[model samples]
Target: MKKLIGIDLGGTTIKFAILTENGEVQQKWSIETDISNNGRNIVPNIIESIKYHLEIYGLSREDIIGIGMGSPGSVDLENGTVIGAYNLNWESLQPVKEQIENGTGIPFFIDNDANVASLGEQWIGAGKGSNNVVFVTLGTGVGGGIIAEGKLVHGVGAAGEIGHINVDPNGYTCTCGNIGCLETVASATGIVRLARDMSEQYAGESKLKYLIDDGQQVTAKIVMDQAKENDPLAIKVLDKFNFYLGLACGNIANVLHPETIVLGGGVSAAGQILINGVDHYFQKYTFPQIRNSTKIKFAELGNDAGIIGAASLVKRQS
Candidate 1:
């Protein structure tokens, strides 16, 4: 059986996996990201790690058919260069493809990390069996990927940015310098921000209010927990979040009419509460016909989505 290598590169860690051509992970490992010296060591570290793992597994370079990678930045698909990844401290274009191919002597491919994760979920997770899918990640910030007819929609290299969808005209400014983007109110940070602001103005008795009064750090999880416990303030914050999130997804569905909109990321870990809240507004906002066809669900692949999706890149070419 032919083998493939997958790499999910992030700011904190780089997840590596060896998989069969069919996308079954055979072995997986990770290494801390080295951001020192303007990230000059990043690619070299990846190269060395792959070499080490290959030797330990008693596999030769010829055993691997191809390598696929997901990186955090704007990827120049034609050139395989990552442009201006602030988290990786890459202020300039980095020739990731050339460097990795040279170091490994293997056919390599790359794409945005979120894009690959979306591909992964579509291929085998929540969106499996569907040719069209949209994946939204709600974490520190919001990220998204869109796959239409089994192909990634890379419109001008930023097509699937679901987080930047304008949901509020007078809401908070997002990190992207836009007002009322979904990220400002739907992300983990966004949820906390809403809770804090609402708590100050709310006179109602709630756990969130008490927590804030006691000077405790409020998190998205805390807010969700409080909401679950019937805290009025937390529920209000969650309602606002779900309203914007459902609104965003509704608009996206109206445009793409995808089979599934898979939700993932840290905030998504809120599980049923998050989905239920979003679904309520989603049902309210989506087009009548679309509401019947487009379904929203949690991603099943979890952290492994990136690695599997990266390998799918090689599979697509092969």
Candidate 2:
């Protein structure tokens, strides 16, 4: 049986997999992304990794159907190049498609990582059986993807930069050089900042204070855990996180009115508490019709999402 290759390329690691057309994983592995030489090694490393796996399985390029790749930054699908991937130290358009295709002799399709992850969820996870889906990832930074009318919307080359949506005019500057982007207030960094800032203002009655007083490093997880136990300050901080996130969701609802909004990433590990809070605020801010139609839920694929979503690229064509 012919199989497809799915690759999730990140700044730190490059995850690879072989999958069936139905988005089922067969085998998976990862390798350190060599960011040396200004990320010049990344594409070559990916090609070699895929070939290595093919050899291991006693299969050749002809036995594979195609390749699907999820990458960071704005992707020029027409030419298959990545533009401005700062995390990878990529200064200009990186010719990912040409390199991989030249080296492996396989047709490769690429899309933004967050977009693919969203596609992955829609394919076999939380958003299954739905065509209109929005996936928001609250990780070290916030990112998201949108699928509408049973298709991914590329809207120029920068469609799904959800993290950069302006939420606060007076808020701190985001890594993207924008002030008050959703990522500034709704990401892991944002959560920690909220906890610390709130702790400073109400320094006396918070578990975070105890942690700070004892020199214990406070993290987003610690804050959420404390909030789950009814810590006042932690609850306050989470309120801020949910407010911005929900506000973003409301804004998206007006634009797309997606059927499902799935939350993923490390911050989402806070679970029901996180989803419930965001859902509360989302309903509060969104239109009545949108509020009644959209459902918020947890992303189910976890680390496999990127690969599975990438695989779906091939699945769609087949």
Candidate 3:
């Protein structure tokens, strides 16, 4: 049976997996990214990990059909160059495919992690059977991928950056040097930031305030927990988040009219709380005619989505 390898590279962790053609993960492993010292060592570390996996599985080169990677940066898929990876501190790394092939003797392909994730969902996850779908991941930062007509849209180096779309002209500043980007107010970190601001403003006797004495360590999960317990302040925070999320989704729906919108990332773990909140506002904000057609659902792949998706890319290429 032909096997494939998938690699998902993040700022803090590198996840890899071996899988069959049908997306079943035969084996998996991970390693710390160790970007603290220097980002230059990442390629070597990745190569070593691949070697380790191959050795452990006792698989020869013939057993592996191809390798695919979902990298956290702007990638030139046609040329296999990582133009820029802000989190990885990489710039203009040319021919990543050739480099990896030289190291592992396996042909490799690469693309933006978010785009690959959407593809993964479409192939074997929540997006299965859907030809058109939009995936939004609300993590420390928000990331998105667009799939239309059964093809991944890659305009100008993964230009489907839905998170960077200006949702609030007067909102907080984003890491991308933009003000009021969707990620600034709708991401997991954004939720925590909003909760902190609210906790400070409403410091009377809220559960959120108790979670953070000085508002130093607020997290999305904490805020969700407080809201789930019916804390007024926490509910207000979620209300605001959902309002913006609805607005963003409304915008997306207007443009793409996707069959389904898949939500993933840590914040999505809030389950029905997040869904209900978004759904409530989406109904109120979106175009009445289209609202009923667009269905919003949570992504089922979780962290494994990237690797699974990356591995699945081999099939697309073949």
Candidate 4:
């Protein structure tokens, strides 16, 4: 039987998986990303790793249907090149598709990492069974993907940029050179920033303030945990985060009216509290019809979404 290969390329690690065409994983592993020399070594290392794994599994290039990869940056699908992947030190357009196809002698496919994750969710996770879905990832930075009518939307190759949505015109500057992008207020770093700002202005007793004074590294997790314990400062910051996140969702729903909006990433691990918090404001801004139709849920696949989603690229075409 033919097998499928999935790769999720990140700044730190490259996750790999061998899967059946049906989206079932047979084996999975990872390697540290060799981002040295302007990321020149990255593709070579991936080819070598895949070759080694193929040997171990007693499989050859012909036995695999295709290889799929999820990468960072703006992807040129027609050319299979990624642009502005600064984190990978890829200063210029990298011919990821050409290089991988040449090295592996197999068809290769690639998409934006976040978009691939959305495909993964839609295949077998939170967005399963939904023809239209939106996925928002709130981590160190925010990322997003949109699927409609059971297909990924890639309008001009920049369609699913949910992070860059301006939530606060007067909010802090985002790395993307924008003011108050959702990433600045809804991401993990954003949450911590909110905590620090609120603590300084807060006059009441706050364990969050005490922790900061004690030199404890205050993280988004800490903020959520503190809120769970009813810390006033933490609660205020979380409420703020939810407010922006909900507003973004409300606006997105008004346009797409997707069947579901799935939240993923490390910050989403706050679970029900995060969902409930966002839902409160989500209900306020959304139109009554859209509000009643859309549902916000947490991602089920977690980190694996990348691998599965990449593989689904090939599965989708097959």
Candidate 5:
């Protein structure tokens, strides 16, 4: 039974897992991301941790057939260099493949974190058994991954940017300098921004206003909770979010015609309300036949998706 190692590198934390060839997680752990010295310590720390865990489990690098890493930026799969990871503060491209492979004496592969997670879900979660799936993760910012015709769509290795799609011409400017991208209206930050703005416009009292009055940062969870209870202002904000998200999904359906659109990330914590709302608009905006055929659902793999997806990279190569 050959085993593999999976790594998910994020801005704050780096998660790792040991898994069987069939995608079962045998063991998993995480470590804080050390971005000091312009993130010089990040990769080294990961390498050390992997060594420590291997010793604890009484296994050697030779026991692992390969390693798959998911990082948060543009990566060149062929060369294993991260072009840029904004949140990780990688100022320039790093020879990530050389460093990791030299340290572990194992074959390694890499991909964008979002795309890795999408592959994870398709392998063992909501999109299981579906060769074509589009995964959208609605976190602080939106991230997307698309699988078309049983292949991960990598247009110059930077495709599947669903969030940056220009959904509104006059909407708020995104971090990417795009105005009114789907991310601006469908992400957790976007949800809070919409709720805060709407609360100010309305004269009546609202739960979100209480959070504002108390000096607490407004959160998407707060808005979703209030919306579930029928708060007029919160519902309005959610409607705006759902409209844009659904519109995005509809656009994806029209273009890729994927079998499933799996939603994940923090804002997706809203669960049924979030999916139901998005589904309504997705149905309205997608082509009539596509609208009915495409299944919209929640991601089943949550945090584990990263590791599962990373391991799939090795499986894919095999």
Candidate 6:
């Protein structure tokens, strides 16, 4: 059986996996991403990690067909250059593909993590059999991917940046140097920020208050838990947050008209609260004719989506 290697590089963790040609994960491992020194050192660490995996499997370099990676910044996929990864402290990187290939003697490919994640879902997860789908990941920050006509859209490395779209002109500022980006009000951080602001306004008689007496450090999870317990304040926060999220989804649906919209990332663990809320507001905001056709669902692959999706890149090329 042919094997391929997939690496999902994040600011804090490196998730690597070896998989069969058919997308079955044979082995998986991870290591901390040490970015304190500089991002240039990550290449050596990744090579060493791959070497360890190869040694453990008793497999030679020739045993692997191809390698794929997902990075968290603007990537020139055709040239394998990472333009700017603020979180990784990489201003601009070149020859990342060359370094991996030279060290492992295998062909490699790389793309934006969110794009690869969308591919993963389409290939084996919630988006299976869907020709057009939009994927939104609601983590510390929001990230998105667009698949149209069974192809990943890459427009000068800027496509699928749904998170940066201006949702509210008067809303909070985003880390991307934009005001009122969807991520600022719909992401995990956004949820926490909303919780904090709401806690302050409500003052007493809020479960969120009980969780944090001073409301100095309420988290998204706390908010979700409170909502689950029927806390009025928490419910209100989610209602507002999900309304924005659904509005965003409705806009995408109107434009892309995708058959399905897949939601992923940590915040999705809120389950029905998120799905039902988004669905409700999406119906309210979406075009009347398109509302019934666009389906909303949760990503099934979860954390494994990146690795599996990375492996699917090889399949796609084949």
lDDT of 3 by residue, 89-131 (tens): 7765756787888999988888899999998888888888888
TM-scores for the candidates:
0.97, 0.94, 0.91, 0.96, 0.95, 0.92
Error of 6 at 134 (Å): 0.9
| Candidate 3 weakest ten by summed lDDT | 34-43
Q: Write the per-residue lDDT of candidate 5 for residues 198-247, one digit (tens) a residue.
A: 87787776776677667897788988999998887888889988999999
The residue-level lDDT of candidate 6 at 38 comes to: 56
Q: In order, what lDDT does every prediction score?
A: 0.93, 0.89, 0.86, 0.93, 0.90, 0.87
Model 5 Cα RMSD, Å? 1.6
Candidate 2 wrong stretches, greater than 4 Å: 213-215
lDDT of 1: 0.93
Better of 4 and 6 by lDDT: 4
At residue 233, candidate 3 shows an lDDT of 88
Steric clashes per prediction: 0, 0, 0, 0, 0, 0
Stretches of candidate 4 off by over 4 Å are none
- Which structure is stronger by lDDT: 2 or 5? 5
After superposing all C-alphas onto the true structure, candidate 6 shows an RMSD in angstroms of: 2.0
Where does model 5 exceed 4 Å of error?
203-205, 209-216
C-alpha root-mean-square deviation, each candidate: 1.1, 1.7, 2.2, 1.3, 1.6, 2.0
- Candidate 1's C-alpha runs over 4 A off are none
Q: Which pairs of residues have clashing backbones in candidate 3?
A: none
Candidate 3 wrongly placed segments (more than 4 Å):
34-38, 92-94, 199-205, 210-216
Between which residue pairs do clashes occur in model 5? none
Worst 10-residue lDDT window for candidate 2 reads 203-212
Model 5 steric clash total: 0
Q: In terms of TM-score, which candidate is stronger, 3 or 4?
A: 4
